[model samples]
Target: MNKLLVITVLVALLALSAESFRMPRQAEEDQGTLTKITDAVKTYYTDAVNTVSGYVDSVKGLQLEEKAKTLYTDTTNVMSTYAGILQDQLYHIFYHN
Candidate 1:
């Protein structure tokens, strides 16, 4: 009868509404996961850049006089520090970060 058909349609509509509401919760969880991953990547990249910049500044600060002895010593020290920094950064980027 007419009442039976109307009741059936209302039940179907209610089921569809329930499904629609659940979908938004699933979508929000997925979006939050993506945001967390993006933020982690951003933080790693920023730390790597800052560490590299510091190494560059330290090397640039090394100034030796006209004598080759002082220049050689300074260069050796700066090169060792630079190498260590680069190694640490690469390790983080590849393994940790």
Candidate 2:
């Protein structure tokens, strides 16, 4: 009877130790999954920020292009007016002299 009791106690202790080891493995797996989820979220946000920044830069470039075109047109008009005035003055001097 004493031998049977000792055997039973040894079996119970072994089972408890096995369960304790398994719990730690389960916790480690859960922690790994959480880490992966966090990294994915960070990547998604970083991509989103980059996309928005690109769009803003595109819009600014288009605005600058429009301003450049307007300035070019205004400069051309001023040059044409100056040329016309000079031509009129030269024609009057040559004819009236």
Candidate 3:
């Protein structure tokens, strides 16, 4: 009976030790996924800025200052949208867990 009790305690300790290792492995994976998402968002924002720059140049070339101003305002709106998406993703990743 004493030998059986000792074996049971050892088994439980081993199980918990295994679980400790598993938790950090899962956390590392989650961090990697979050990093990828952040990188993609940065790329998208860069592309958006480039598009606005090109549009401004084209509008200026055509002597359409009013249209250029409107496009600039629209570009600002798009940047705000991107900012909102980034904030939501950060909240979901950091707080939802």
lDDT winner among the candidates? 2
Candidate 1 error regions (>4 Å): 1-31, 64-97
Model 2: colliding residue pairs: none
Model 1, total clashes: 0
Off by over 4 Å in 3: 1-31, 65-97
As a TM-score, model 2 comes out at: 0.39
Q: What C-alpha lDDT, on a 0 to 100 scale, does residue 77 get in candidate 1?
A: 100
Between candidates 1 and 3, the lDDT winner: 3
Q: Model 2 over residues 47-91: C-alpha lDDT tens digits? A: 999999999999997898889999999999999999999999999
- What does the lDDT come to for candidate 2? 0.75
The residue pairs in collision within model 1 are none
Query: Which candidate number would show the highest TM-score if scored against the true structure?
Result: 2
Estimate the TM-score of every prediction: 0.35, 0.39, 0.35
Residue lDDT tens for model 3, 31-76 = 4544555556558769999999999998779878778899999999
